[model samples]
Each structure stands twice: as structure tokens, then as C-alpha cells.
Target chain A: MFKRGTLVVVAFVLAVLLTACGGAPAAPAAPAATDAPVAAEPFKVAVVMPSTETDLAWSQAMIDALRSIQAEMGGEAAMQISISENMFNVTDAAAALRDYASAGNQLVIAHGTQYGTSMFEVARDFPEVSFAWGTATDTGEAEGFTNVFSYNASAEEGGYVNGVIAAMLSTSNVVGIVGPVEAGDAKAYIDGFEQGVLSVKPDSTVNKTYTGSFGDTAAAAEAASTHIAAGADVLTGSAQQVVGAIGVAKERGALWLGTQSSQASLAPDIVVATQLYDWTGVLKDIIAKIQAGTLGGTAYDLTLENGGLKIVFNSAFPGVTPEMQAAVDTAIQGISSGVITVLP
Target chain B: MEQLFTLTTLTGILHSTIRLATPYLFASLGETISQRSGVLNLGVEGQMLMGAFAAFFVVVTTGSLLGGVVAAIFVGALLGLLMALVSVSFRAEQGISGIGMYLLGLGLSSLLFRLTLGSVQSVRGFAELALPGLSSIPVLGPALFKHSLLVYVAFALVPMVAYLLNRTTWGLNIRAVGDNPQAADTLGVPVIAIRYATVTVGGAMAAMGGASLSISAVNIFQENMTGGIGFIAVALVYFGGWRPVGVMLGILLFSLVSALQIWLQLVGIGIPSDLAVMLPYILTIIALALAPRRTGQPAALTRPFNRGMA
Candidate 1:
């Protein structure tokens, strides 16, 4: 009897495991066939992301933009979207890209920089399908690809603006940065932030540390603690991993400036402001170009001047005084009008 | 470099080191018990992820930290039980099954998170409980005494586990099963039962280690948030030479080095941040190499037992 019970338990657990594995990778059931003569054969778009759609960081920004576009174009019926999220492995991501392309996704979006090599390979095979990937400006033109689109966010512009706000509100002349890695957009944001802080308070100290990972929340939290211990009153960082740092900042009552996405929802009280990425304008442009037969070759950038990167201040935190707000607005205008160069 | 020597900086490093090491301590110590019973569970990372999600989910919905911790422990044990059924009862390859478990835990937790809560949310997890008198000591007080309840529980488990593994009759039976299962079986020891218990306990502890992160350390959960900490915990068991105190020391050394590297970057002493970040990992390899070669590996580890076969 005991042996029989054990077998039953094992079978049940295995069934649950199989179901869980089966549930993922099955892209949310394609918006149930609309009976009312679908609006213009739903523009099929597929996206392969490095992390989950709700990471509230890099991946979330793109997903939110796509959702807004879908809403604008009339719902799921007018704009069909398929997402294969958490594709951290390049090989697996390559396979996912191929699968989407073969399945007739007209415009396939590989939403991570690491997917460049695989994307170009897949784009080569499906010349008719338009491919887009970003936080990069490589259109793969030199590499001989035409159906590929590249978009980048001039993150430093908003990073500099956030830095200006941090400098104005910081009581202790010391600021801290919990960086992920010293490369890509993360690097650009940090460099620009340091410059903004120094531009305002030349004597203020900004201690920066990269935890060598984009997902090591524990390490990020420790870095935040280290910063707080060193007398830093204002903190800021980019990437999805900043959630951990934000938690630490909230506990220590340190003001935080965010980048890449709006982290105001994570900790409204302590997250004073966030430099959010609004990719809607860029996505629409890419869609239009693709529809107009301009499959590739042009690289686009999301900048403050183009109204793609926005600085959103949290109302829950009263730290941004009218003067501080004015300083931020001035910095934004300067960057947008080309009067202020964010990076050297 | 001199800035790192200040009392505040030193104490700060020490404080963060304890907080950082708590998860490793729980997971590795639990791994020690499992390996001591001759079952090597490589699915610890998966167990931790499930535990983290469970704890975070419960806390967000119920607003009770205790409820979160309990849910984590329960979910962890259930996964552990599944591992036992696959390895101990079915006699499948332990390593392969463990990996399968890990993938299952990862996918299930992520799917559940999406299906239920849908977005990233934070909850107030464990609050630091400063000891009555010891918390007042200068430098060390704030550094060591003030931490979430889980940190204290994790450290306390080390000695209890040590005593359980060294002094108790049950510990002897576990050691016998790991070292010579056939002999243990002939002598009337319930090998399968002991293996199940140890593996299940290991899963529970690994999960708690994960809970420590979501409910205590960061108080937030993201997919794969453990971020290979579970694998590191498994390595610390080998580094500690399969002993509880040794595992505790290993965890301290690794976490202290990690803490030091973070400090090095904070002080900006001119070393590149990339090189600074590699310090803990590089130091761990060096320490593992330099340590005395005392192979205390369980002979029966990874060997599924059968009554009549050798």
C-alpha cells in the first residue's frame, strides 16, 4: 500500500512538472479569432526578450511600449503580438528567433543587444521579414543585411538630468551609484550622472561600484549598504537589478534616482525620480518604415530631444523643490537643444 | 586604501558580510546534511527559487512575514520530497534528476508569478531584531547583532547541525549510510528513510536560504533572483570538506571577500571595478587549492542503493 501511494505521488508531481514546462514557451493564446472581419489582417509582431516581461527594467520598458502601440492600433485584433520572454541563453534565443520568423511574424523584435549575432543570422535567412533589436545602433548594413533595424536610447541625456536633481537634493555632499557592469548603456548612464553631479556640486563625492551582474540582487543590496555606510544620502542606478538597491535605499531613507524605467512604483516614498524610456515613438517609426518597404539600414536613437527618454518625478517624495525642479528642466532643455553635451 | 581602514568602513563590511553569507550558510549547511546521508542534490538552485517565490507571494498577499517563511519552508520540503521520490525511490541518476528538479522549480515559480501577481511588487519582510545587551557593543554591535531573524536562525543552525551530525545516534546512522550503505543496511539501518529525511531537510534549508533573500535581504522577487547563489552554496559544501563548521568558515571567507571587493570599489583606490569584482571568485579558487587535501567525501554519494547488487 505504501509503495502504491509513493508511485501515485511521484506521478502527480511529474504531471505538474510537465504541465509547468508546457505552459511557458506557448505564447499567450493568440487573441481569440475575432468574428468581426479582423481589422486589416493583424500586423503580426514577435519579440524575444532576455528577461521576463514584468522585470520593471529593460524588458518591461519594451513590453510596455509594445502594449501601448497595440492599444493605439486598436487591440489584439488589429495588432497581433507574440512574446518569448526569459531567453537569456544566446543559443536558445537564436532558436526562438528562427521559430518566430518561420511562424510568419512579419516584424520580429529581438529585444536584447546580446541577440545581435543570432538575429543577423536569422535575418539573413528571412529577407522578407523585418527584424529589429536594440540598445544598439548597428543596422548590420556593413555586414550585408538590409531587413534589420537597430535602435538605441541616448540614456546619458536623462542620466545627466537625474544627476543634476540628485546633486541639488543631496544633504550630504556624497552620492553613490550601484552599477551592474561597466559597459553598454549602463556605462553611459553612470558616466553622464557623475558629470551632472560634478557640474552642479563640484566638490561632491560620487562613489560608484559595479556588482558584475545584472540579476544578483543580493550583491546589489550589499553594494547599496556599502554606499549608505560611506555617508551617501543620494543613490541611483540602472537595470532591473536596481530593485534590490531600491529596497536598501528605502530602508535607509536615502533618496534614489532611477534610469531605464520608471521605478517610482517600486518604492514611491524613496524613489524621488526616474528617467523612464518611452519607446513608443521609436517602435511606431520602425513599424512605419517596415510597412513602407524600408526594411533596414537606418539606425534610430531615443533621445530627450526626440521625447523618447523622459524624467518622471515621484509626487510621494517632496524632495524636489521648485528650484530643484527648475534645475532639472533647464538641464533637459540644454540637452535637448544640444547646448549641453552629456558625454565627452 | 587607507579609507578602507576606518572603523565605520570596517564595521560596515563586517555587517554586510553577515547579511550576504546568511543564505549561503543555510543552503550549504543543508547540503552538508544531505550529502552526509549519501544523496547529492544538485537541484538546490531550483529549490531556492521556488522557496523565494513562495515566500514573496505569501507575504504580498497575506501581509504576514511568518506566513511567508512557513510557505517557503513548506514549498521547499515539497520539492525536496519530489527529489527523494525520483532519486531514492525510483533509483534514477541523482545528478540528472536534480537538474530536472532545478529546471522545474525555475519554470514553475516564474509561471506562477506571472499567472498570479503579474508584476514586480515589494513587501516588508523581516525587521532587524537587535539583541538586548549585545546590540549596544561598539563597532560589532550594530554590525553583527542587528539583522533579520533568519540570519540569527541560520547561524544558530550551524552548531545544532554540527551536534546532530557528530554527537547523535541518528548522525552516526547517516554517516554510516553515506560511508558504507550496504554495511549499514545489513546492520538494520533504514537507508532509504534516512536519505529521504536528509534530502528533504536539505531542500527545506535551501529554500529558507532563498526566503532569506526575498523576505529578509532584498524583500523582492524576480525570476531566477537567486542568480546562481544556489550553485555557489553547493560548491561551499565541497569547500568546507563536508563539515558544518568548515562550511560556516567557508561562507564567511567567501562573503567577507565579496564584502571587501565591494568596499574596494566604493573607496575607488584605482583598481578597475572589473578586477575588484573578480576578487571573491579568484580568492575562492586560491583558497580551495591551498587548503589541506582531506578528502572527506561520502563513499556512497551519488550511488543509488539496491538490496542484492554491489
Candidate 2:
């Protein structure tokens, strides 16, 4: 209770509170002419996702990419990451996005299309803060915001490849596409798949159904069943709830191709290939740009040539033939060279 | 588009109907029991979620599908006890309490899944068990006799629930307490005890519906996986006029129209995809408008009974 003891105690309490608040790490003083000192601040990225990180679809894809990036770039101490997941409600998501920027995060990724308005609004308030979002190609340039970056994938390139293989393997000459909604990447993938099937066999009919929701497993399963009953020998879909469709396919002994993330583990034998959305390189580039003072204004498109739109063949699939592999490779090359335009 | 009524297509539609109706059947049947006892447990969705998570976790940890189902039932019963405590014993506002229960179930299930499972993973779900001899009988066999054990349980509960709510002495007391609790109290029927029993049964059955979804239908568990289907089940309770047979009819109509809508889209039938997607909901609303005013609803539904006040 002495006066000197009280001064030390108060100073200790304030330091603990500040650290607990996660205030920006105090920049170490310019070493005072010390040797072997690193001057870089930790690169922190905060993400607000619409679904759980374990969704194995859109949200999971980003999370997996972040974790891999974290490990590759010298782990958590060097690169800090925080996530607010299951933000399906826009109001909560907006609050979280604002909170992250205010907390002094170096980069914030609002990982959903529905978040565009909130993200832009929040981005406007913090011009110096870096923000990213999408399944979109716009960087908010028309709005004159340089701190917002967009990323979209050419999922059709992989979907087209899947359709080619599906048609070749199908005896019924029918492929089914189960989609969550008929917009954005879902539409692009399905459209590409239809054309890919027709490219191999002009008579091949690709039936597509949109379940109206990304998380409706029951609906997805029902759609898969209807497609199978209608004589589809192969099926493919993108989104989180395609797990249900894949389950039905595995049961009926039908082949399945997946996208958004690898679904091979869900059904090893039946899953032929997955359009792996490898955003790792893109994410790394974004981080590097943020580190280099280019907060935003650049949008990244994942295409075949960039090593982002990869067709990951499941080793467990027995349906693959040497001829089918050759055809898929040719389609990839044609797509990369711009010789083939996938039209649905 | 023109030749829509082939035997093969009809059978396929019928099969789809049965598959889609399982969750609805379980949920509505469970809700019916609670309403029959004068407790409007609008927490069926929450109960279903708790059940789904419990079932999923148990199955993953122990590798026992049966254990997963029972765990769901156990969780449901515990939650029902919570509901009974809040509404029956405490006599809180039934509507608000029911909603609170719903939110609690929703939040806890999601939190638990993230904590325990860490990520979405799949377990070996219940396989379809085609009944011997019966599964071979032309179109009907493949459509009706080929389903998982959970499907049979859901369908079987219809008759069992009918008999329980109508025939037994306990059923008589439930109806009595639900209609006029003061009168039942005068007649020496334990009103509070019967309410707890009925709510617990309702919760367990609802949880079973959720388990059926994860373990049998979808074969994987995801957050918000029930996707408001529990709310639909509650609607079915009113649509079915609170009768087991009537509820069954409502479920069949819902699943049939749902399947037919998807089929229409596939066949390139001229209906706009947006309108077609809304077929089941539109049909449900239409049926409700055309139906009777009071479809055997209990006289004291959602009313908490206090002995001293009465």
C-alpha cells in the first residue's frame, strides 16, 4: 500500500489491459543502432464469412487457403488471422466488418457477395484500410474507392472439363447439374458444364436444377435423386450443401464432380474430379500488395493458366480412362489458349 | 412436356415424396403431441437442432448410428424438461418462452458443432434397407418398401400417435387437461405431470426427426442444416388440423408438390423456375385458406394453467 508500490501496480494493470484489448503491437523503437533486428509489423487479416469455416464450400475454401498461407508465410506470429464466421445475417456481418477495421486490422476480407454494400460502405469510412470481397470482378472503382479489391474465379473452365469427363463416362448420355442459385459462379459453372458435355456428344442432355439456397441439403438431395431417376449417370454441383447431393450419388453408384472445394473425401470412389478453387496464390499476392502499400484497386481472376483453377483428379475414381484424361487435358489447353469459348 | 404421366415418372415422384416427407412427418407428429397437452412448444426447431448435433457427435465419437439417434432423443427430452420448467412450472409467457427456446437451441447446436467436430465431417449414415420380398413388387416395392429404418419409424409413428392421442387413458387425460385444465384438476388428473410428459415426448420425437435428417437423409451434419424445416413442421400441425392422419396427409401433399416442381423444371415444362420453386409454399398457403377454421385445436392451447388462479 506504499505510494511507490501503487505506482508500479497501476502501470502493470494498464499494460495488461492494453495488451488484452489487442491494440496494435507497439512498433519496436528503431533498434537504437542494435544489430539483427527485424522491423516488419505482423500482417493481420480479419475475415467475416457468411457461413461456418467448416462448411466445406465457399467459406471453408477461404479458411483453408488462409491457414495454408499462414503456415507458408512463417506461421501465426508473423501473420495473424481472425475470423467471424456464420454471419449469415447482413446486420451482424456489417457490425463485424466495421469492428475489425476499427480494431486496426491491416487487411479485412468480407467473404461473400451479399456483403458488397456493407463492405463498400465500411471501406469508404476507412480509406487507408484494405478490404476485399467477392465472386465479383469490381474493385469499387466507379465509386472511387481504391481500398476495395475483388476476386472471382473462372469456375466454368473446370466445370467444362468435368462435363467432358462426365459425358465420356456416362452410358445414359445424361449429366445433371445441381446448383444452389442461378447466379454468379453457380450459373457460370453450370453453363460451362452443359457446353462441355455437348462438345463431346452433341446429343448429350445436361439437366440443371437450382435449389434456391446454398445450405438446403434436403433440397439438394431431392434434386440429385430426381436427376438420377430421370436417367442421369453422372452428377455435379457447387456450394456447401452439395454434400447431400454427393451422398445420394454415392448411394446410387453414380459419378459426381465437385467444385468450390475438393469433395473427394466425401465420396472417394464416386468422385471423379473437383474444380479446386486454389486461392492461396491470389491471397498471398493480395497480402504482399497490402504489405507493399497497394491496399486495393486490383481484382484477381482465378483462371486455368494462373494455376488457381486446378482440376484435381481423385485417385480413388475408377471411371477415369486414358482417353478421357487425354480429352480433359486437351480441353484445358484449349481453354488456356482462348481457342475454346465455353458456351452453355 | 406433353407426356408427363408415364408409370415410371409417377413411381419416381411417389418415391421422392416418401423421402422428402420423413422430417416433416416426425416434426409435425411431435408438435401435435405437445399441442394436444395444451403446451405450444414452438421450440421444435431448436429441439431438432439439439438432436441433430447430439446424434452427429455421438455417431462420430462412438461410430454407432443407433447411439447417435438415442443421444438425439436424450437431448430432446432434456430440452423438453427445460421447456416444461419455463412454461408449465414457471408459467412464463408461453410464446416468448417458446421463441427463447428456439434461439437457445439454434445457438447452442452451432456452437457445439464447431467446438466438438471442429469442422464438417461425415459418418457412415444409415443405409437403405430394402425389405425382403416386399421390395421386389414392381413399382410400389421400390418406392414404398425401400427406405432406411428411420423412414419406417417416422411413418409408423402416425398410427401409433393416433392411437396414443385417442385411445389410451393417458390420452384421455391429455385431451382433458389440454381442453380444460381446471376441470381436469377437479377430476384428480395431474395436469402439470401430464404436460411435462407430453412436452418431453414431443421434444424426443422432434429430435428424432432431426436425427433422421442427419443420419439417414443427408448423411452429413451441417450448421443450420434443418434450414427452417422445423418451422414447416409447426405449420403442418395447424394445416393438418392437429390430427395425426390429417398431418400425414399434409406432409404427403407438401413432399409431392415439392418433387413435382423439380421434375417440371427438369422436363422443361413451361412454368417459370421462380414460380415453380415456390410451388410447395404456395400450395400450402392455398390449402390453409381453403381449410376449416378450427381443425380440432385444443380449447386451452398455449395457455399456462395455474391451480390457485383457477
Candidate 3:
């Protein structure tokens, strides 16, 4: 019995070693996708998202942008948009990303920062597949790849706008921040918002709380309630969990400033303004580049000046007076022209 | 500390604590009965998710909280019945069966949410029922008296659940089947039937917990809404040692720490918010470590019963 067991174990070890040796060899310089320039027959685009498409935060914003892109360029029949959403597991996400590229998708978009590693690795395998990913700035330029396009948003531009409006709308001289995790975009939005508030109303207190999760609605709601209890008449938050906060703002009648997407559909009575990220311009440009055979080298940055960041005030919210509109316009102009720096 | 422990802060903490505890309490109480009857249902989390989705769907379509909760209870009961068929009648491995149930709940809820809502829309939630004269009383009055109707039901269930499990003849049969199924069968107690009934009831309770979360507390449905709170409910049974009051106390300890962390973040306490989040989990680990050497789980728990000649 002992001899048989030892034989089986040794055989297993040998098999593993042989399998490892037979895997893909290291390639020094892979061929670029631009060499072939695959013709776009109907513009097949596939995207992978970290959460549900209806989360109303990061994933929802991108899905809405993709939908709008399809509508503008023609209908879904013409654009052929395919999405794999609620992929919280990175491993599953990587597999889906590979499948889409291998199945002849014209342009594949991996829509989460966590997917960066898997996306770059997969992009190497299919040199003809144009890949885009972000909330990051690295376009694989340093990696010597010409088929990878990167996209990131200048959320602070909207964050600054949200802040100026929050500071103006806060009746209690106190504004609260219910932040998702301290990621780059969320942090930029929060910091720029604080700067905008202090610049306008220095005396107002801005308390910030990170729920340490991206999708836990109850935790977000708990943070929001605590802020309301602490005398914050005005609140601002970012991410999908902001839905929880939106529920609270609606219940308590507290003014809410939104970011990333247009949240006016939710809590119409309380939502004052939202810095909606309109990626139509960026999406159109990426498609245009693909048609022109540029595949990837350019990294698109969605900012206020380039008509990517749109500040949409909720028409249903009662506090949108003419004076408030003028102040917001001035802030927008100042930020666009480099007169008002919103780096934080 | 003195400055932070004001009346308003205490009230706020209490308010959030009750809402947070509602789902946990409903789930644990239901689990307590199932475990007491010697059946382990690991699919409580899945059941909770199903219940949450069912309630949210009904309420969104019909605009009635009563209809939503009723649908959740029905869904929960059906799931409980299914669990009995998988684990009891078919005599499949309980652990694997429970896991199958979990995956079903997780996947189905997400698919249903996408197919139905397709977007995040706020639905109506239950109103806070403040006891007029009592709510005017100092500290405890405002904190305890002001809560939604579901919160009151969750608290009231404790004593009622305790009574149902302790004093009734039906309870005796359940305990008998759990402790010694052969003896129960010989005594004409209908062991299989008792186990099936207990597990089904447990399922209903777990689903109500989900209903409390989506319909009464959060008023919005998203994928995996219960998020692992159902797994925590399972842990709670072990922590509570299969008793109603004990389970309630375990939930309170966890929620109190959670409430404290939220309040501290607002008061500008210097502790990192992540560390604050870890406090309750750390406390649960400590509680389990300090628990008695022998937990009072039923003898036949997780074991499928056979009639004779084993």
C-alpha cells in the first residue's frame, strides 16, 4: 500500500512539472495589433464590469455611456454592444475578457481598475484586438504595446463643481461626505469637493467618512444617517452605494450633491447637482481612431474642458435659483480656463 | 469620551443599531430553531437573498409592504420545503445541498434584478412608528420607542419563539427527533415530518429577515443585498448556543460596536475607520473563544435519519 501511494505521488509531481514546462514561452517583443488593422464590419464592442450594470455608480455610469454611444453611432443592432457585468471575482472577469477577445470582438473594454493586469496580459495574446481600460492613465506606452488604449476621468473637475454647489446649498453651515473606498477617483472627487467648499465657505464644516466598501448599501446608509444626525443639512457622495445614501437624503429632505452619473432620477426632491461623466466624446474618438487604423497609442482623459464632464442640475430640485446658476457657471468657466486649479 | 456620549449621539447609535440588528435577529432566531431540531441549514444566506428580492419585487410592482413580506414568506417556505426534499427525503449530503441552495439564491437574485428593474429606482419603505407619549421620555424612550413596525415584530418574536420551543408538545417531538430519531420513530413521533416542518419554519424566519432589510430598512434591491449577513446569522447560532435570548444578546454586542464606529467617524475620533469596522468581528472572535467548552447543539444535527437496520 505504501509503495503504491508513493508511486501515485511521484507521478502527480512529474505530471505537474511537465505541464508547467509545456506552458507558453516568454515572448520578448510581440507584434502590434496595428499591423493587421482588422476592418470594423459592424463595430462589435464587449465590456466587463465589477458590479451590476444597474448599480448607479461606477459600472452603471459606464453602461449608460456605452448605451448612449450605441444610440449615437446607430442602434444596438449596428453598434453590437455586449456586456458581462457583476463580475466581482477578478479570475472570472479575466476569463470573460479573454473569451470576448478570442471570439472576435472588434474592441474589448475591461471597465475596472482591478482588471488592468488581466487585460494587459490578454491584450498580448491577441495582437489584433484593440483593448481599452481605466480610471487609470497608463496606456501600455512603457510596455511597448500599441493595441492598448487607457481612459481615466478628471473627477475632481466635477468634484469641485459639486463642492461649490454643496457649500452654497448647505443651510446648516455643515456638509457631510459619505465616501466609498479611498480609491483614486473617489478621493480626487472628495478632495476637490472639500477645496471648493473651503474656497467658497471656509467656516462650514466638511466631515468625511469612508465606508471601506464599494457596494455595501447598508454601510453607506449608516454613514449617511450619522452625518444627518450630526447636523449636516447638505450631503455629497460617490459610487454605487450612494443609492443607500440617496434613500436617506430623500427620507430626511437633506440636499444631496451627486457625482459620476446623473442621480436626478433618484431623490428628485433633494438632489441639487450631479457631475455626470459623459464618455460619448471619448467613446466616439476611440471608435474613430480604430476606423483610422490607430488601434491604441492615445490615452483619453475625460475632463470638463473637453466636454466630457457635464454638470447637470436636477430641474425638480426646488433650490435651483438664477443666482445659484450664475455662481456655478462662473466656477465652471474658471476651472476650464485654468484660473481655478482643482488638483486636489 | 464624555463629550461624545451626549443624548443625541446615544439616540442616533440606538436608532442605527436597531435597524442593523433587524436582519441579523430574524436570521439567527430562525436558525436557532433549525439547529435545535438537529438540522443544519447553511443556505440561510441564500434564503435571505431570495426573500429580499421577492419582497422588493412585490413591493415595487404592487406598492404594498404587506404584499411584499407575504411573498417573501411564501418564497422562504418553498425554499425550506426544497431543502427538506434535498437533504431529508433524497438523503443527500447536507453540506453540499446547502451550498447548492446558496449558489441558486446568489445567481437567481442577480438575474432577476437585472431582468426586472434594470435600473436603481427608489421604492416606498415602512414609516417609523414613534410611540407618541413614550417617545417623549428621556434617552431610552426616543431611542427604543421610535422604530418601524418590522423592528417591533423582530423584538416581539424573541419571547414568542422562546415560548414555542420550550412549552409545547410539538417542541418536545422536535427535540426528540433531533436527539434520537430512532427512539422518536419507535414512539410514533414522525421524525422525518418533524424535521421537515422545523426546517421550513426556519426558512420563513430567515426570509423575513431579508424582507426587513430590503422593504423596511433599505427600501432598494441590489444584487446580493444580504451580502453575507446570512453567514453571520449561522455564526450567531454557534455564538448564542442555540437559545433565543442568547442569540439576541450576540446580535446586540455586534451591532453596538458597529453603531459606535459610525458615530465615532462623525465625532472626529482619530481611529482609522477600517480598524473601527473590524471591532465587531474581532469581538465576535473573542466571544467564540471565551464560549463554554461544550456548545449545546442537537446530537442528530446534519445527520439524515433512516428508519431501521442501519
Candidate 4:
């Protein structure tokens, strides 16, 4: 028994040694994806979004725009959209940047401000791929950082449009905004929406409730219901999954003005129109800059005049008659043509 | 106001209770059995998180609800075996090792989920399963019969667990080991093996509870999505008098409070929605404070057994 145990131990050691020796030679240390060779290849643009594609709201709109832009450009440009949900983890951001950069992507567009720093760092490392961030904050200064830019929407302007529609359509002169949170980035929209609503109907009492979450549909629904019960005739929100809020409005038969995307189809009767952000145009212009070789490393803001932000009213909205539509069209034309300016 | 107590409300309450309790029922039963065998597995929460992540990812990738559930159970059992190895074999502090297991599971599961899923915004969930013959019945149809298969399994496991703990030889060995490990060891019962087996079974059950929530109840997994269900389930061991039947009743009661809160919100009851959302946790706290502590906890719980102690 002792001899057998010793023989078994020896055999195990020999087996391990042979297995180690037969293993393939160590591969060379590969270069980081961002540091890899970048030659004249298909223009690679990466869309780093805030959420997954299944969200069916802001994230989806961006996806649809990129796809439409791709389709329109006859599939000549390669646009890859990577989505992350509530992922503020620096490691995750770095990994995504590394992967995209390694793929020789010359242009990386981060849709949220949270990803800005990591994207910029990755861009600095590569120094070849250009990085653009959609942000509500200013990018401090321009330097050897020739590849980082920040962009923002005219969200306050969008709020103004929603306010106009709500004031015109409301029966009770009581409007409400179900905001996600009451601080920071959302505060601008809240103040702007209030200004917009009060501008159109000075007597309109705009009630506001913060659902404290951006993705809790149940919470959003409950908050919307509370507003409706409190005598708000028109409802709006800056919340993602604002569709749930729309559902509440539809259930109560109240008018709702849209937020990020054209939510008119969610409830045609309730959703009069959305303060639409044409992300498609934004993406196309970005791609155009890349093609024109004029792509700056600084963030770009496209607004109503630049065809990036505007309100789109559905044909079926009750208060939007031919006259109302023509007036809105005239306003849009004036804004676009620099005949009128809506300031934030 | 009076309509809140009507038939629709009561039925809704019951329905909601079942949904909320399903995860708890499975987890508490596992804990009960583990405790009954002189093992206190504190890794229930971590096991649950892993199960939730596993089931969510599987369901999303395969588009197979059933596949997700099976995978969750399998992964859960594998985790259970790991817990058993450290606590039973090495004779380490079961609590510490269990906690270590939990941390490992939690970190690993979250890492894997982010790597694969790419942190997408939302995941599509499984639809409710309405029973053919039973679902058509009034009142009970939506409340009891029309729930996910996991919910049914949760309830069914109650009686099954009760019977196993009371009537069987294996149950007898478990109780013997838990009550007097040295005495059981003298009688040729492998006390260590029995304790490990019971604890492992408990871990798997907890995993199932977690999976039920991810794959059946919500059908999507989010960060920290178990939302303290595992801790609540662990607390439920005290709530249920550390017995299968008692655990089921406790789970059902807690779930009832949850459902009541939901119903109140649906009807626009004059209450703060956040307060209503907090009702279940409040009830759990109350239950914990009100329980007769001495009678509920097992005599040998969290204490490792040694044959020489006899």
C-alpha cells in the first residue's frame, strides 16, 4: 500500500509536468485596442449610450437615429452603438473604450456625461481616435486633448415647447411635471418647464413631483396618477420610461406633453406632442464632420436652429387645428430661419 | 374608502401575498432545514443575488424562462456545495464562511452580469401563467391559480418540506444531529455529513427563491435587485418559529402586507406612496420585535458540533 501511494504521487507529478510542457508557447503581449494601428479604414463611429436598446425610449431613439443615418448613407458608414444601464463604474467605461478603440474606431460618441471622463482618458491614450461627449456641462478647455468634445440638448427650450402645448390644451389651468429627481441636471428642466407653462398661461398652477428614480415605471405611474387626481389637466415629465407616466395620463384622460422623444404614438389622445430631439440629425452631422475631416475634439450643442431640437405635434392632437399647426410651423420656421430666438 | 375592503381588494391582497411570499417561502424553508441541522447559513442573500443574476442572464440570452430557472437551481447547488466544504469539512465558523461565500457570489455574479449584458437599460420579462381549468374560477382565478409556476412550487414546497422534517428517517437524523450532535455521532450518524447536506439543501432552496423573483416575478435582474429579500427570508426563520409550516405562514403574512400596500396604491388611497411601499419592511421589523425569541431559535444553531463533546 505504501509503495502504491508513492508510485501514484510520482505519476501525478509527472503528469502535471508533461501537461505544462505540452502547453502552447506564451503569446506576445498584445497592444491595447486603443493603441493599435489606425489606417485609412471605414469610418468607425461608436455610440456609447446610457441604457440598453430594449428601454424603448431615449436610448432606443438614439439607436433608431444611428440606424436611419446608416440607412440613408447607404450603409457606407459603420456606426456601432454600445449601451450601458446605470453603469457609472469607471472600469466598465474603460473596458468599453478599450474595446472600441482596439477596433480602430476613429470616432467615439458618449451619449451621457457620466462616461465623459473615462472616454476622454481613453481618447488621450489613443491620441488618434476622436471622442465626443453629449453633456450638460462645459468641457474646461482645449489642449493636446485634440479628441474630446462635449454636447448638450436645448432641454430648456424643449421644456418651453411642452409648456406651450400644455397651457393651450389644459382645461383646469393646473399642470404638473413628474420629474425623476429634484436636483442637479433635472433641476434645469423643472425650472424651464415651469417658466414655459407660466409664460403661456400665467395663472396655470404647475405642480411638480419627483419620483426619485429614473427607471421605476411603477413609481412614475403612481406619481402621475397623484398629479392627475390633484386636478392637473395636463401632465409632463423629464423621466425616462415616461411612457408609464403617459399611461397614467391616458387612463385619467388628461393631456400629456412629451419629453426626450416623440411619444405621440404611446397615447395619441393624451400625448399632444413631444419636444423632440432629432438625434438622427445629430448623429448624421457627427458622421458628416468625420467625413469632412473637420470633427473637433470639443463637444457640440445642436438646438432648434441646428435641426437638433424641436417640438413635434401629432396630427391627431385635438387643440392642434390647421391654424394652430400653421402657427407652430411658422414659429418653427422663424426659429430655424433666425427670425425668432428662444433662449435658455 | 369602505370599498377598499371589498372582495376585489381582498382577492388582490391574497394574490399579491402569494407573489411576494413565493421567494420568501423557498428561502426560509432552506434556512429552517439548515438551522435544524446545527448549521446557520448566512450566505442566503449572496446565493439569492447569484440566482437572480443567473436566471436573468439565462432568460435574456436563451429567451427560455424554463432554462433560466433550471440554470439558477444548478448554479445555486454548486454554490451550496462550496459553503458545505468550508463550514463542514474545515470546521470553520459557519457564519464567517457563509458570509465569505456570499461576498464571493455577489461580486462574481455582478461582474459576470455586467460583462455579458453590457448594462442595457431593460430586459423583457416572462408573462404570467394562467392555469387552464383552475384559472377560470372566480376570485381565486387571478389571485391563486394565475401565477408563475415558481409561485406554485414555493407553496408546494411548504407541505413537502414539513413532511420531510417530520416523518422521515433523514429528518430524524437531522433533528438528532442538531439537538445533540455527540449523541447522534455515537449512534453511527455522520454528524458533519448530515449538517453539510442540510446546509447545502438550504442554500439551493434560497437560490430557487431568488430565481423565482428574477425569472418569474420581475423577469429582469437589476443591480442589488433581490432588494433585501434574502435578509428578510433569513429573518423569517425567526418569524416561522424555525419550522416549515411556520415559515410558510410567516412568508404569507409578510406578502399580505406587501399586497395590501400595492392595492392601496392602485386604488389611490390617501397615503404617501413611499410609505405604502415601506409597509412590508415595517411589518418585518414588527414581527422581529414581537416574536418570543427563546422559543423560536434552535438550541444548537450556529454552534459547530464535535463528537468528543458527548
Off by over 4 Å in 1: A1-39
Model 3 CA RMSD to the hidden true structure, in angstroms: 5.9
Q: How far is candidate 2 from the true structure (C-alpha RMSD, Å)?
A: 4.1
lDDT tens per residue, model 2, B211-257? 99888887778888888888889889999998999999999999999
RMSD of each: 6.5, 4.1, 5.9, 9.6
lDDT of 4 by residue, A85-129 (tens): 434455776678768876667677676666766776777687666
Model 3 - which docking category? Answer: acceptable
Candidate 4 residues lying further than 4 Å off, grouped into runs, are A1-344, B1-10, B56-65, B115-127, B132-137
DockQ of each: 0.62, 0.61, 0.47, 0.07
Candidate order by lDDT, decreasing, is 1, 2, 3, 4
Query: Residue A32 in model 2: shift from native, Å?
Result: 15
Ranking by DockQ: 1, 2, 3, 4
Residue-by-residue lDDT tens digits, candidate 2, A9-33: 9999999998877554453332343
**Which pairs clash in model 2?**
none
lDDT at B173 for candidate 1? 97
lDDT of 1 by residue, A189-266 (tens): 999999999999999999999999876777788889899989999999878788889988887789999987788888
Candidate order by TM-score, highest to lowest? 2, 1, 3, 4
Question: Any residue pairs clashing in model 1, and if so which?
Answer: none
